[model samples]
Target chain A: MALPITSKKAIREWKLYIFVLPSLLMVGTFAYFPAASAAYYSFFEWAGGDAKQLIGIENFRRAFSDQVLLDSFATVSVLIVFNLFKMIPSILLAVLIHRLRSDRWQYVYRVLLVVPMIVPGLVTLFIWKFFLDPNLGVLNGVLEFTGAKSVLVSLDHFFGWGVFFANVPIGWLSQPQLILPSLFLWGFPWIGAVGVLIFLAGLQSIGQDVYEAAELDGVGPFKKFLYIELPLILTQVRLSLVLLVIGTVGGYGLQLQLLNEYGGPDGRGMVPGLWMYNRAFYAGEFGYACAIGMILFVFILALTFVNNRYVRIDK
Target chain B: MSACPVSAASPAPRSNARRDWAKHAIILFFILIELFPLYMMFQVSFKDTTTFIRQPWLPTNPLNWHWENWTFALRLILPYIANTVLVAVTGTVCSLVFAIFGAYFFARYRMPFSRILWAAFLVLMLMPSVVNITPLFILLKSLKLVNTLWALIFVGIAAGQVFTIFVLRNFLEDLPRDLFEAAEMDGASHLQQVVNIVIPMSGSIIGTLGILAFLNMWNDFLLPLIVLRDKELFTLGVGLIYLDGEYVKQWGQIMAAYFVASIPLIVLFLFTMRLFVRGLSVGAIKG
Candidate 1:
């Protein structure tokens, strides 16, 4: 029997709210409340857990004039350029795996590819630091073995930028000149299991009829990739791009600082997130840290809005 | 880069063989790049500290290898593994339980402010979690949870639950109405219908979500770093950092510790890639 539309019906509908209430309370306390409080803290001048006073945007004004903060933005921009380009390998690996004729080969590649994902990211970074070490590095060893060290020296002299030095020993993690470039080169070949899986899923959704039609016109592999696969997988590509943009710009730069390296080599590798963290935890300037965080949030929020508007895969 | 000639219906047999070789070569090259660093760490874990420093790339002489690193590293950090599992499991279970209740209700009922609340949750899901650090630390410290696993568990259950709820809610929304309607026709109450219909229907999704939450919490470095302080309370992520500090000059020991940190997740992935891949491919990372 259908229940009449009355107080009973209203009570049942509202009963569901009880189920949602705990979740709401938890999220409100942890995520939403913190976010709101972050905004509120931005206007105060508090330090070392002492009594506070209203600062009235002083921290933000300081953010504008802060040279270190400005340089961090530039450093992040350069790092982001490399991060964006890293998507190419992810796409390429996805395509290669998709094109494999054998099911066993596809399974093998998928399983093998996940190896990198399981390893801790920081461990991989640690290994890369060792791999690129100037004195004891594998990369430099290869250069010496191949007798390309002399060529690198000549090239470094020709460029006059100290950008390429094989025999002269490049400082991969030190030397402000090379640190950003070294950071850019982080996550070399950058294809992770998630990226490949996302792209493969996108590629698998394409109809065979489209490829068959192209084949009839004698479109080869390269043509098929360019005209068919690339366009079709634009959504997946966009998804990866937006994620990379956010991760590089807002999320990971703080990680570099947390490693206790702060800004590598004369502050060339500084980022706003790290600066915010330094202010809050190190300097005990919680209010200023919140203000700095608000500045970074504005940039991230703007980028996220732009990405959602322009780069949604579902569209 | 050239397309096939218009006159040709198919490539020549010799060129076909050549093409296969080229594709295989390229695939093999990428695979090596993927596997090389991992292999480097694994191989170096067998060397003595002195040998590793003097001849960094030398092949480990099986006879001369120092296997003590594994024993040494594990002895130091196995407690952290246990701690990590305790926190990760509790956080994941709580997240799943809360998500199941919240997602099912949100899916089945249109209560007041539900849409607005869900929209706000969605926006929070998209916002960079780095933004939450400053205030969350203060909040957790105020509650005296800073040096305990509960801090990570609570934060995870609160913030980490968004993805699980979003995924499960979408899955429930797509459920066939007839299934639940038939239950309603039988005079089953909403709770009974949910117990009978929703729980059983979402079994695979529950598996996917549970594994993802577990892995996410386990691999989490930042939250535990910010919250947990005592050496005894360190999860594997934080433990691995401390391991690095003690073994900074010992490549063999560091590599051993790294492998110790990596092995559990690797084992987990090997067994659960089917569910893991499904969870990943169905757009969990959309936000």
Candidate 2:
């Protein structure tokens, strides 16, 4: 039933191959070409114009010693840690929704969870920015209203933190020392709708018999979650973990929008992608930016490889 | 089997009710926390600056609600919304069309270099878009497509092809091969087979992928921000950013604009809620 390489049937089947051409062309021209050009242009001194001079490995050399770039990596590492902590709420929410006894209520909650996603992520970021506003933000209003401000003020006094004081509005996004914490505070109760749905899918696959077995063993809810549910959803967890790393590492839109081009006060919020954006756009160091991009590509590739290699789930 | 002490001869209905109440309270608490910002946004959208600052966390009186904020924001963002919808719809349709054909090829026939072609698409998924932004910008400029909606559509198509094709190919692969073979025996061309059989069989999937591609384009500001220099050509995402910068941070008007920007996707989701959920679950299973 197979056609040999030189057979007439294969020649006759050539027309079928036309189906793939358009996609290949689109991908080759738009996606692959730019990536290939990034590699090629990484060695040049181009300012995004006609004038470009070849300077092999110099761009990479500068990136190695760039203090801001190194610091940006450190900044992202902190955000990554915060993001890891953030994943827990989604898992918890999914488990909660999955365990609901009423099918009607379970369906209702799942739909409710997805409602937030209809709001564009950009709009959400801006809303959070408004929330972090020092003078008129809801966060500060609630803090002052609930007497949390007084507690924070007392704590600041005890610790000599100097950042919190009574009667003075706290600059959550403005003060350099507060930027990273402000980022963590963004997307509060971070039950990502999609993440929850994903984990729910995994959890729903557990047979009812498993739960009955657990019930027979007198296992409490906590132990049931630990022994049965957690293990079953570990596959989804690992997938999310890989995705989370790649997204956090490569993402700069949040920092770019919140902190501006230079990454806010003292560049406290700078990440590698934002730095690359700044270099290419503001500084006109397009070549060096490409080099930075290449470094990021390699780093992400290796990180993904290691993640898949080490984070094993016994299926 | 040994019954648990709790579930032995008679289960405690009262305790189960209490536990159910606790679960509902916990879930509701988290949901309230999650939805609080959006709730604040909606409430603030109806207030003037003075009212918003004074009553920062509460809804304004109905008589004092600033409907003009909505009117003004609607006027300002209407053009950007139109541009975004045009780009998203056109790009989604084109990319889906391309992906359908490409996916059909991979799913149906095993031709020479099929593995290489499939690998090419798969590899793009691993490559981060961040690394390609600068060079992609340059490539667009040289092609003289910078500042044009076509640039966004083209790039969206390219970026969308990999995922759409990957997912659709899997769907197509699972379709009964006999249906295709029967059609082929009737002297139907490949294009005809796709139109007659593939499209009809995979309508729901096509709809799902289209929504996803449309959403990706609608939310994407970075590419549009980089490519489009003209204010008139700005999509909603970039337009909102510019509006935020240009305005004096008027809370009511800005929040109203944000609300207006969110309406299209919300309406889309409302109508296609089931399809959207199924799409995501499908992706979850596959991923």
Candidate 3:
């Protein structure tokens, strides 16, 4: 039974395909093709050469066992933890802002919170770095004024504030232990800018009737949040989690800036993104870097899929 | 359920006072925490090394106001800003053009493989930028597009298309089908219909998409870092990093530079917050 196909229908279909062709070509050449090449490169030990030796799975094997890789994994895990800690509070703040009755006040807060997001990453990084500067930095000065020893030990030598406060400086950036936390402090406020915006959207979508019902039942604000608001906005929470996870794992560009591309103080703050970057560019370990990138891609894909499924189920 | 009497509905006066105090304290605490860092940045930007060290917490005495750092950082960063603007604006314009036409087709015609094409666009939207970095870098290098602003503009346009198309397609799909059918009945060509109808109706969506795309392109660091070898081609993100590395010890100047770089974005965000928020919510929630 041959299906009757009209010439008009066939021409219309062909025209549509023609319209989509340019976009497909662009995506294939720039995105899909490169993605496939990255996967292929992951399997062999080819370091920028016309001829390559085949080392099947050797690159992946080395990537798994490498100490630097392991360290980066641990660092990324810690970063994710800190990011959640920061992001949750920011979301709560956004919800609070949305709860305010005055639209004028809400706009003011939105503008202030959003300022950080617009700030160039370079500027934000430098401002925070200055704030934490051990010597002549404002943070140390505040600590000294509060009857505490200077946080920056180097400052004691330069300022000569007193012998009692002449201990080694906080060494915020130079110290490996402080590097991760310092980076978190520098980056956390910016998270609020985006988090508030997302949360504000979520809050608005929630039906006011739910809140009114809770109130009629003599429910407190906290109980209403737990029983209604929280459940309704779970989709936004999941989206945010997925975003934070990807950003944490795949975001090494900022670290390279703040930490001078060495992951700051013995590579304590080295993330997977930076690890892949250093491997490919600095060490010319193209195969290994691609393997790491593929692994990250798979992880992100799996997480996003899981998040989407979870959201669907909740709905 | 037991209902309380109307006379007993209100809380005790003492309890009300306590609740009011608690609310006020909590709000004040959070406001201070949020504003303090920004305040510190502003204060430090004006202070010299000695005074900043002597009283970091106190308001600047005599306000040294290092206006010179502004000029210095501007001298260092202006080229980068110009480059960023060029790439972001051009990329956004190209993306909008492709997305508008593509979305119009998807919404109007029930073409063969339409479902599959839509699904492909969605999947591409989920594909993270990190996954494409290495191959794209090599591809650009092979094309001899490295160190040029065009490399960034092209990539940005390509990368932004999927989401823009998705947003535009959704808006277009919600339009009345009869409107398009009537245009077709009047013998209007597809291009003419798009020009006469879709473009006019899509003003808000297009404007929103343009703003979002521009912001993303402006803030982007990784693509420029890889493709731009010449310092002059550096975007704001890369330029700031270069400046930071060069003057590692000059914390004041670095912060000052950051302050200057952030102002334009802040202004844009402040003025367009309502539109930005509305667009973000629509795109995010609908997806």
Number of the predicted model whose DockQ against the real structure is largest: 2
Q: Model 1, which residues run further than 4 Å from truth?
A: A1-8, A162-168, A253-261, B1-19, B187-191, B246-248, B283-285
Q: After superposition, how far is residue A219 of candidate 2 from its true place, in Å?
A: 0.3
Interface RMSD of 1: 5.4
Global lDDT scores for all candidate models: 0.77, 0.87, 0.72
Over all chains combined, what TM-score does candidate 2 have?
0.96
How good is the docking of model 1, by CAPRI class? acceptable
Error of 3 at A141 (Å): 4.1
lDDT, candidate 3, A1-315, per-residue tens: 112346687576476566567666677778888888999988878675566677999988888898988888898889888887877776667666655544555666666665545666556556667667787655566667774664444565678633323555566787776787687776534445666667776677655556556668998878867876677677777777777777777888768877866698899988888888887778777777888999888878887778677655343
Query: What TM-score results for chain B when candidate 3 is compared with the true chain B?
Result: 0.85
Per-model TM against the reference? 0.92, 0.96, 0.86
Worst 10 residues of 3 chain B by lDDT: B1-10
Residue A3 miss distance in model 2 (angstroms) = 11
lDDT of 3 by residue, B205-270 (tens): 888888878887888887887788887778887787677667435545665667767776777777
Q: How big is the positional error of residue A279 in model 3, measured in Å on the Cα after superposition?
A: 0.6
Better model by DockQ: candidate 2 vs candidate 3: 2
Ranking by TM-score: 2, 1, 3
